[model samples]
Target: MSPQLGNERRAADGVHSGESGRFTSPVRSSRLSPLAAPAFRYFFVGQVVNRVGSSMAGVALAFAVLDIDDSASALGWVIAASSVPMVVFMLLGGAIADRLPRAVVLRGCNLVQGVVQTATAVLVITGYAEIWHLVVLQAVAGTVFAVSYPAFLGMVPILLPVEERKAAFLLIGQATSAVGILGPAVSGVLVATAGPGWALAVDAATYLVAAGLLLLVRLPPGDRSNAKPSVIGDFLAGWAFARHLGWVIPAASASLVFNALVSGAINVLGPVIADDTIGSEGWGLARSGQAVGVFVAAFFLAKVTLRAPMRAIMIAFVVWCVPMLVLGTHVNVWVLSASFVVAGAALSLLDLAWNLLVQEKVPEEMLSRIMAIDGFFSFVATPIGQLAVGPLAIAFGAGRVQLGCFALAALVAAFALTRRRITDVRLTGGPPPQLTG
Candidate 1:
């Protein structure tokens, strides 16, 4: 062939090859990179709406149950029922996230939560809301939430650029904290006047709004190799990763035990404590104080980047224990409110550090699975903690129980912090290396 003809043939071949490659490649467009795109705004907004609504619903639910059951033991069972599903399905949820469209999963989860909330509202309004009914509904909600939580948590990296991922998480956390501030306050009024039904209806409405926002946003396709793996293998892979990672295992372990003890105490006994020790008004005040503390910490966190993540984590945990100790001391309602405020501040800071570390250290495809693992471990003992707290308080007495929990948590946190394995983590200046070949 002539030289011109030969060049034309080569150009045609190149075009065909490029077209073929486009059709075969698994990766989708990264147009929504959190740093560079406007879509992240929608994602962030949706998160704010969803979080605020959920927070309100949480307040309403706890108070509603307390109104009916009244006993800490009954309350413990109700709280435990809510968290059990999360522990059971988190890893599978992670695998599902890795294999599916995150936006679709999130939207579906929100819809399910909306339905659950609506049902709860109906139950309460009709006077059909038995304690057992609440437990069952809470379990369903927890299961749906298990799917949504990992998918949403994993979506951040997919939605944002590696460089700005920290900013994305900070934005999300700060927005949630801001909602936490207002949600409980508003929920208290709604619960006081119209009953828990009204607050739940609001929560259902918020979920609808969140769903609409998410539908407007788009996400890139995720890794789907798990489609071929057996269920057990997939779960084991997630388990193995969590168990093996230096940062993940310890961090998750700490979170698991800490949240179990803290959330269990707060969720089960907080309302009772409020009613007896501080009054109903004081419950909202304490919640608002904590939310404000979180908001303030988030504000500073968004502005300042950390070089020493492990140290930040350690300090935050120590900060967390102080409030527990203070609460145990029975320093009056004002002092307890102050303690919760400080505790909330410390938790917000701790969460920011933890999120950054997780995002930086974990692979993107496995992020959901890792998150699932984290959620499972962090929450698995929560019910146990919740269940145990009531009886333990009865057995050892409330004051000693509180003190013992505080001391154990503090000692564990301190030991974990001092370990060379945990304290050595630094803020990765950029995203950890992409796992893609």
Candidate 2:
């Protein structure tokens, strides 16, 4: 997702206007308007296809690991293997993306991902797969993603102008939500019938297709005359810009805590609990329900106007604790699925608001690096959490661990709300206010 102005411009008063003194951008509310641009159209199709495959792979990977070794500890190690590399290489990836053509970098990374995923699929399909094989393959995949994601974040501005971004983001979210609904259900069927290997193979094919699509996306050449002397210098510049923002550090800290405790507990232990209770098919439906919620939120938010977007976003963070609470206390699949719907809506809203905030506030020249720094800080603790959660579950039990994680998440949300700089910001389609340090 990238977006550009389509026959519309902002007037001197900061309101989008046409020759008739009224807003004229259909991109604001019409779902298909952004697709008019050839660049966004190609990018959108590829992204949707890729997301569908990746979502299926997410479920398939979990079950495949459990099939190999049913221990939570084993699954934890495999997931951590991937995340650790992402944390280590994320800044470098961002610097590279900033220095290169984003589309070309993304195209190359997708090709690598296809190859790695193909190899992993073959190993699993041939009955010679080991946990180590998966750990190694996923680590390679993670490295590719760490390099590609900052390009992904910054690509939107390049493809589309600022006026159309909110709509483009919402449209992308809607498409992702729709595919997310299908991916896990289809993955469950594939995993149950043809096996996880086939599901992963499908994921591999999508990457190749995405790579092909990226070839069609023509972007303006990036200016390299002001390039940093070194990768470290590029990163230091991004950090310098980021460190002065009062909200950035606290938000990053909250993200670190949230992903570490809340997300770790869910990803490591949720499947184990689901396997023992609702089974894989039901687990897939539960995830689909979450996607449905995301779609609903995206649909609703696109139609409404927000007076205080950041404040609403903070409230949504509190709602994110609902899923852990439900998983901790409820054994029924429907109840778990329903709770996930609420949590998913909250997550979708928060994600959209946060992305818009960053894109609006950060300068285009430094956007990729800032996004990389944000990702680096946000995910630095994730591998540690993933690695530890399984053993903690083994010691304290999954239910207790989930409940404890939920409590901690709630505390983090509460602390975040007390920061006036985070809560006071508004998105009103004007020049970004100078944020207080």
Candidate 3:
């Protein structure tokens, strides 16, 4: 074939189709290498800022409840309130994200989130923040995430090349993990020093800043002229599309049960354990350890390529059982921290793989809707777990409850691996035909 034909074929496959190795436009080659494109830089910076605040809020909110109401179930109520709305509205969010310029949706959500967080901070600082008020407000805040998450998922594909998705995801993981490392500890200090109110105020400020940054980003218009008007129809359609796939369905099903059991158990139990044994500071330290592990894994996995997508996820998920077992056993703080570190690495790896896999396999137009469904499945049951676990711990032993949750998570994860697609599915990191003329 002639050189021109070769270049044309290569271009069709989404490779750098330039005659020379170097792409005249750095954006094409800059996928693996971050910050080459202006859009990515802005998005990355805004996201890191926003995530750090979110991470800090997680630790802060738990302690805030502890301050006013010492009941474990109270904390559970607060967490459940937020998550339920997030699950309920997620599909609506995803449908909107796919239909509009994602940046518009993202910016609007961030602005609203900033307002909500500010209100939360005011309530806390004034000593007027009741448990019911918090629960109500968090439900509002949850809707922000419901919409924004779908939009956020769709952003990178528009900004970066197909080949760089892994790198982009890993980089994002790294940034969030870095936030994980500092955000909790810093939040602890702030909660200890000024109050949880200040940490919340900080979160509010980040959202405002993120909203501003999002305005600076320009994106291609979305194709939504054919979208349906009914929310329920769109939601069911998302789930319908989700359920047929071999890899997607099982993974989501596993996540649904796992979140109900594991995530809620951890959220409610982890803080209670901290208060009981090592105190809040020790809990923060353990969280810091988990963050460290995540940060380290992000850097390492960013460079490492995986061939067998589902099997790698299964193997990593098996290790998640260890941390829960150790925590439930009441082993020392050092040991628990170590356990958290291991759990962090495995969880981060699993998350990276799952996200990259979605981006690689799903069509860009449908990515947000699918991701919304994925989010719905992944977290839908969390409120159930949160609501149940604390009470279960009160009834049964915390140790027993935690152990049971771990066993269930492991069993479901193991069952997920039993599917043929788990081992057989491969991520070639395909160079899908993606670049515009």
Candidate 4:
């Protein structure tokens, strides 16, 4: 039987030993934090592989568009095709995660992605690749991710102690940022030398590896077999809880706005900034600087516990905007890179704290669904931002758009943090939450 089903059976049989003590006790030692859990190790490794592969594939795909059609608009559509599916299906994906075994969902998704990427590689290799083909393939890949990511994220609580959720996400954020540092440079070299087809093939191989690692993981349990709800009902349940939470609702909405504006700039304008001001190599250096910041944050999170982690996260969220403001005004690659590094470090802090806050405060039964709702809405604005950035830049110039995004993001984050009670939430350091394991 799948691990999800197995976990459901365990929950039905009432396995709660060692849970209360780990959950309710005041967080004592940061020595054996949650990231050390066996299940998390497997999940983390798989995510690392998948992230690296996706980065390589993404770079290659953009190059492929340039090679095939040489039109910037065509490239934009191709890239946007991937994200559209996520906006459409992220909530539904979360519902599925709540209802299913997380491990099974992750493994199944990885397997399917392997097939899709492999097929994509073959089509490109055969010289039948077209812009439409890239769009269709990206949409398929995005659909799988919509389901996979929620399950992956929701699975973290099941594997680790609730108190460690922050550290765990810190670990993940750092790893992802590291990949961001390396993926582009690697992709550029691979595409330049081995061709985009080979890069896609490599992506397929990584998914296979991810699937294998996931198969080794043994999840504890979640409320997967609770009474099933209609998709709308499930989504509404999650939304209702999030909306009521003093901390989560506003934080999520503000983050949504911040991410929408910033991501669009990073995706569209960062490259322009690099190409126009510093050159393509400088772009890579700026990204690497950001990754370095993330790595530094992860090292701290892996070691120490901060009092009021969520408050720290909110502070970081505000701090993150400063770099964008600086970068908006700068022309030098070194200056842009330094700003990006600071922004990335701040982002790492935010990711760790935010994930920990929600995982600790929200009921585990609703986690996947809630995450889905959050993910869906949070990312919904990204494509809009991406779509608008080019036009905004064309009309007012890249500098103006970058400055506008920085100001808008800072305002949203500042407004969200102004809530008085938002700082009061924290993890109970007992055995763990009821549904965690």
Reference-based lDDT, each prediction: 0.71, 0.79, 0.76, 0.70
- State the lDDT of candidate 2 residue by residue for 1-437, as single tens digits: 12222221222122244543234444453666667667878888888888878989978888999999998888888888888899899988888887787889999999999999999899888889999999999999889889998988887766655666777888888898899987888888888888899999999999999999988887656555466799887777677777775667667777787777754777777888888988788788887877888888997878766656666776777676677887788778788888878988988888888788887777556677888887888889998888888888888888888889888877777887888877786677663333222
Error of 2 at 262 (Å): 3.6
RMSD (Å) of each candidate, 1 decimal: 7.7, 4.7, 5.2, 4.6
Model 2 pairs in collision: 2-156, 3-160, 3-161, 4-160, 4-161
* Candidate 3: pairs in clash: none
TM-score of 2: 0.91
Is candidate 2 or 3 superior in lDDT? 2
Residue runs of model 4 more than 4 Å from their true location after superposition: 1-36, 69-72, 122-128, 195-197, 220-225, 276-279, 302-311, 318-327, 421-437
Model 1 Cα lDDT, one tens digit per residue, 141-197:
889878898888877655554455666676676668888887887887778788888
The TM-scores of all predictions, comma-separated, are 0.87, 0.91, 0.89, 0.84
lDDT-wise, the better of 2 and 4 is 2
Off by more than 4 A, model 1 = 1-36, 223-227
Off by over 4 Å in 3: 1-32, 225-237, 432-437
